[model samples]
Target: MTTIATPTTLYDPPPSFALVSPFLYRSSVPTSSHLPYLVPLHLKTLLSLGPELPSKALQQWCELQNVRLVHLGRKRDVVGEASTWKPVQEELVKEGLQVLLSRENAPCLVVDPSGVHEVGILIGCLRKLQRWTLSAIFAEYASLAGSQSRDIEEQFIELFDTDLVVIPPLENRIDGVRDVVNDPPLLAPPQ
Candidate 1:
């Protein structure tokens, strides 16, 4: 017989948690206290962005839950100069997009330390790929970002070349993007 795990307290999601799609979610770095709330999501993968290393506790939780954690950012040395830190690279974001588009990685959580800049930029680029208007994309970004939004991130999203994003083949594609891939916008475009 299988035993179901019951939560001892109310569900408390991580800071800035929100759904990106049916199978994709975005949020700030989750703490041990937030682990219980993640149970219902049945996450298959955790795509971590930014330069910081995940806590040992998070690693253990992922191991126990059978969730694959993929960290794309390079680690910053403790003694490294903060002024030398660079913005997230395009190559890494493209790789992350590929991970998100794969059906096998569905029910994935894309997280960063703050979930304001990195995650927001990624989601904005995704919206562009989905043919969403720039205004709409920026609106969504601003809604979550509040006062923390940056013009540089928005510029990156605007300049992002969706042509470079290689979508997975039909069989490997996620349900959310399947329709988008099949029925692309015509010359007239959506009003």
Candidate 2:
């Protein structure tokens, strides 16, 4: 009697990797211009903020830049209720983040143009992101003295190996610091 061998199909093989640009190894995305390179035109960006809406000027800028605005400010649609993002925060970490990692899919940028207390929690939720760094985190009113805000910055430094860049805002607000758009330096890992 002869025995025959059968092909095994218990487990699927991993997908074959494709060639990526050598320049991609660099810390930051290679661009023609030196100024902070915003997300590529190919990808649409979601600009999220607390319950309040962005200013008319800012909204116009985002529109011109082709960014989609999302309001993650309120826990629910009810009015006069305490504004909280607890409900959708988990979904953002699980579903929202994965989508951003996909180049074919557009990424997101959470900003608190009015800069309120909730901004700290937003930053904390953002810290959980693994695949991609936040495109930007603009806080129109930065309260660095607060432990929560400082913790957020510390987390960025530990994970990204670079300080959160504070980008100047278009218009000045109550305080001298117009905004706190923390753009990742996109720097190479230190040798």
Ten residues in a row with the worst lDDT in model 2?
17-26
TM-scores of all predicted structures: 0.83, 0.35
Best by lDDT: 1
**Per-residue lDDT of model 2, residues 70-132, tens digit only:** 555443345543354232233333333333333433344434432323333334333333222
Query: Residue 119: error of model 1 in Å?
Result: 0.5
Stretches off by above 4 angstroms in model 2 are: 1-43, 76-107, 114-119, 129-191
lDDT of candidate 2 vs native? 0.35
